[model samples]
Target chain A: MEILALFGDFTVRTVAIGAALVGAVAGVLGSFALLRQQSLLGDTLSHAALPGICLGFLIAGSRRLEPILAGALVTGAAAALLVLLLTRTTRIKSDAALGVSLSLFFAFGTVLLTYVQRHAGAAQAGLDAFLFGQAAALVPRDLVVLAVVGGGSLLVVALGWKELKITTFDADFARSLGRPVVLIEFLLTVLIALAVVIGLQLVGVILMVALVIAPAAAARQWARRLEGMVVLAAVFGATSGVVGALVSASIRGLSTGPVIVLVASAIVVASLLLAPERGALWQLAHAFAQRRSLRAHRVLVDLYRLAQDHDDLDYASEQGMLDTYFGRRTGHVLRRLERRGLVSRAHHMPEEGTHWVLTVDGRQQARELIRPFGERDTTLDGATQ
Target chain B: MTGLQGWLDQPGVTIVLVGALVGVAASLLGAFLVLRRESMLSDAISHSVLIGIVLAYLITGALDTPLHVVGAALAGLLTVWLTDVLVRSRRVKSDAAIGLVFPALFAVAVLLINVYARDVHLDTDAVLLGEIGFAWLDVVRVGPLEVARSLVTMLVITLVNLAFVVFLYKELKLATFDGMLATALGFRPGLVGYALLALVSVTAVGAFDAVGAILFVAFVIVPPTAAYLVTDRLWRMLVLGCVVAVGSSIGGYALAVAYDVSIGGAMASATGAFLLLALIVGKHGIVARALRRRAPRPPPVVHVPEAGGAP
Candidate 1:
């Protein structure tokens, strides 16, 4: 099969690959994103890209990737600058500054998009596609561009790993050590913007933020170390891309971006439910299993009473009475009791059936579960069951 | 017919009324949006609701007036729900969760619009603009008002939203200020949150046709932001937001008419201008107080004594 034909060669696939690569790289970087508590900055900058993309398209007059990306970079940087300005100039905190900048730039972007749509009709055809992306229109060239940008994003992260980690965990400390805190921060913003632009062609303006944040979030549940989290995030991001692409291929008229989000959501849900110690389901199951074992130990203690009370500690003595006392499930409970050697059936009592009794070890096991319930002396006065 | 005739009968008044109405509604919700620190939620919900509209069309095969609105509500709710799920379960932060959910949903909506919506009477332009001008072109009679059905829809939504905020004021305030305290009091922050989300959904639906989804962010944020400059109390904030919104609406329409520009854009620009003005020139404006107070002068005699000693 032709390599292209086998892949169902289309812009959609190419663009989908671009989207996946963008997601993977961003997810890795986003470990730092989440750690810094600036997860929403992705959303802010992505929206901030709108006006730039519009301006780029307005001047450049084509869907060519490079100019639009440059336009996005300028706007994203401006938005970040405004946020920084807001934080420094006022008593308002970082979140407020972020909120203010996010809304203002996005509003400007909307105005730009609407204005261009109405006025620059011939020059600005297909502009709205950038707003939400036109992944299906991806070409080989677009894929190459994404790969380069995506690779560059990875390189930036790897090269600045020590500096990035230092700044993320403690900017003050890094600054105290006379590190280039401002420069590193600016560099991080540019790299994030680069990730946003790489994703723009496929994931579009609104959802590209999601691509950056989701995998990192899921990876966090599984890893204690930051490096481990970043690696896991990249893996999850790549996997989401693959599954999303396959689903899009299998289904006609299905959009790639939403499917990708759904796939990432699945990964998150799986991690939340299944990851050891932290997962909700695992903890719930562990607690339930512990309770059931405790109850089983209690039932064995009741058998200890039946056999040890009679001093036969054998199957034939008072076996019918023990069965009646233990209820209908007594036979089943008795089997477990015998397995533990808390009870046994004697050869002489084969006709008599099973006898329930506690071995010395079994008696010890019974005491362990009952110990936390308080001693018999403490329980007698309360008279509570 | 009655609704259209009424609207056309007062075309100039209608534009201002529509603009003001959009402003008021957007600003009302904008307060909670700003307070909850989800001001950007407005932007997210408005853009993402296109997914709902397209999905509605796909499911029902008609972008009939009410269905389109309903679809928007559904889509808006879906965006919120997905955001919540991502943030809570995936350990994804709220902003990223919001970012992830809507774009994907919006992309799906746009994709549907691209492939299937062509013959189905769904154009992207109409989706964005929401036929603000055409609202007068079609109408339905309601009791005595003879209002444009769009206005009627918005009015009903506005009233319901007002009622919701009024009744749930205490709960919303408590939750907004201190969610843990609200939970400790057994006031059910979850229920309050649901109510707020529901209000956002309804407002999005109501505003969808009149202002379009993208512009909805302006209304949802601008007024509240401006209001924040003027007041610290929640009720006061809400009042101020509504006032700013209404003022911007009328002012924007007049400006648009004067300049022959897009009414929605003008309205949003006006609101933005008001926010900037409030930030700079309001009572607490940085420039205002800095200019009012001056710093003390340094001692000039000390320098002369040092010079004499050197001589």
Candidate 2:
């Protein structure tokens, strides 16, 4: 096949659909994983899938996607089981458990890979592509396998949604409520393994964890509910997958997994910056505007205090005196209040400098800040002037 | 007699030695990492070290220099620093920070190898998969004896790591178990922690030449974790970790030779087998618990009061 044949419309379509399916399934399951704080478990499961892929190839003596993915599911789930057992039974911490499983299984898989490479000879040419993944290798049959597995995992998630959610947030409470927490936890883990296996061909085992976590992590920025996070994650995952697969297909010598991971990471970056409520930039701007309002409130209250002390409602306090009182410049604060029609700037007669007086609206706001329902709003007093 | 002699000859001794030394060095450092809950940071450092090696080569135009080691160490620290920054930003969770930094750095390294260093020895296979099978081919001489370069490198590292543990035994122990107490006692626990991480990074660079990054992680984590199951004492854990590492190296080499598979990988898999073995047969293992449960207890001596009797 010519290299250009990789870019053929049909091939591109198949690859995109395959990647999207992988991404959506992983994203939905990954939301539960992330919420449960088992996000890194996805990384462990992917690393552990290599030996299974090699074993599957050895058992089938061909590149059949069905056997390959099935093999991945088995070992991946076994790795998760080992991790759970280790953490539950022994003194091993969760992070150590994750690392032990990921590395040992991956190493074991490399052994099988090499064994297959040496013994199977030329027939094993494309097998190592599973290392970094090659989307151009996707045939129509592979796509069918991906869809069946991906769709089945999603269906299981939908049917077991309530149990999964209950276990995720509070396993102890779920157990108290007579839910089979252990069984539910196991089911979720297995489902995550299946999602990871689904993504193995598109993103490969090396970087498949990013697909499992990135979409969910990104979606979490926009969502506060499990349902919304899951849905948004699925969408983000599918979009990144298709875009990455297409880019890899277009570029020569570029593998699919890294491209997809990079794209997914880019989405995470954008979401963290641009998401509405919880976005980093959004929060920063909100804090800044809040600080500005706080300062304006302080200046209004200060002007009110000065007028009352002089026994004149029209008393204008010089900016220099207010700065001395607040121990900082009040020009910017006064100007900001003037923009809001909260204060007016007047010329002090003796000194050629500006003085500030609160308008009627500013006085009312000041009264509320100082004597909120005749009770001090400590919220105003506590802030730095 | 001839079989033993043959096993001792050409590449066999060297391969096992190199694997064992790398395993030993990693486990010595890993005991602290596993205890400190920073095992994943080791994983992150191992992955990002690839970029350091590639960048070092690009600048120095040489592969056989200490610059690669230096570069790898710097890259490992960079991963740690970047993870810290991301977590501190409060936008990314600590776990996600680890997952994000290493893979991105690794991806960039792989892409760089694809674009610029394609013809060099820094291919994806050589860097990630490793070629410990050919370690014997490269030799350096000291005194009248010739040795595999990797073996020498790993030996120095293992001994240095041993020295580190021995010299700062109390400090590491204090920091691992009680950071606040150590801080109050005038031990700069944070500095000690960074020092330990730096050693782990250097050790990773040494082992990277033999077992690759993945297998090195297997060595670093599995043996130490298995040892944790077997013993509660730090000294005992350290020794048991080394024993597991060495045994795996020897056993794994035989398995590889018999099956024609990757030696480093088989060594790593052996460590996992030992962990499973520990899980089943150690003092705290399942069999002991099951036996204890089945064992008959002495009949309970009950102070029985007469029916309807009250004090």
Error of 1 at B186 (Å): 8.1
Question: What is model 2's interface RMSD?
Answer: 1.4
Candidate 1 CAPRI classification by DockQ:
acceptable
DockQ of the two-chain complex in candidate 1 = 0.28
Candidate 1 residue pairs that clash: A207-B103, A210-B100, A315-A355, A342-A357, B26-B219
Residue B218, model 1, lDDT: 70
The lDDT for every candidate, in the order shown, is 0.71, 0.86
Write candidate 2's Cα lDDT for B1-311 as tens digits. 55643553488888998999999999999999999999988888888898898899889888868998889889998999988987897767788778877877887787777778888987777666778988988878755566678878888889999999999999999999999999999999998998888888889889887999888899999999888888889999999999999999999999999999999999999998899898888877666666877999989999999999995
Candidate 2 wrongly placed segments (more than 4 Å)? A1-8, A324-327, A372-385, B1-9, B88-93, B143-145, B296-311
**What are the per-residue Cα lDDT tens digits for candidate 2 across A1-385?**
3434555689898998899898899889988887777878998999999999999999999888888988999999888988887787766789998999899889989999999999987888887888778898899889888888889889988898898888899889999999999898888889999999988887888888888888998999899899999999999999889988988888777788888888888998899888997788898999999998898788888788778767677789999888998898989989988988989877769645788887878877787787655754333322323
lDDT of 2: 0.86
Give lDDT: candidate 1, residue A355: 51
Q: What TM-score number comes out for model 1?
A: 0.81
lDDT of 1 by residue, A1-385 (tens): 2334525656546655766787788788777777777777887788789889978877787768788888998999898887786556544446555666665666566667767777776767766666555556667887777888889889989999999989988999999999999999888888887877777766667667777777887888899888999999999988777666656655665556666767776787688788887788888999998866765776776655444445444324345665666563456656766786665565455556545555667766766655687756232212332
Which candidate wins on lDDT?
Answer: 2
Could you estimate the TM-score for every candidate?
Answer: 0.81, 0.91
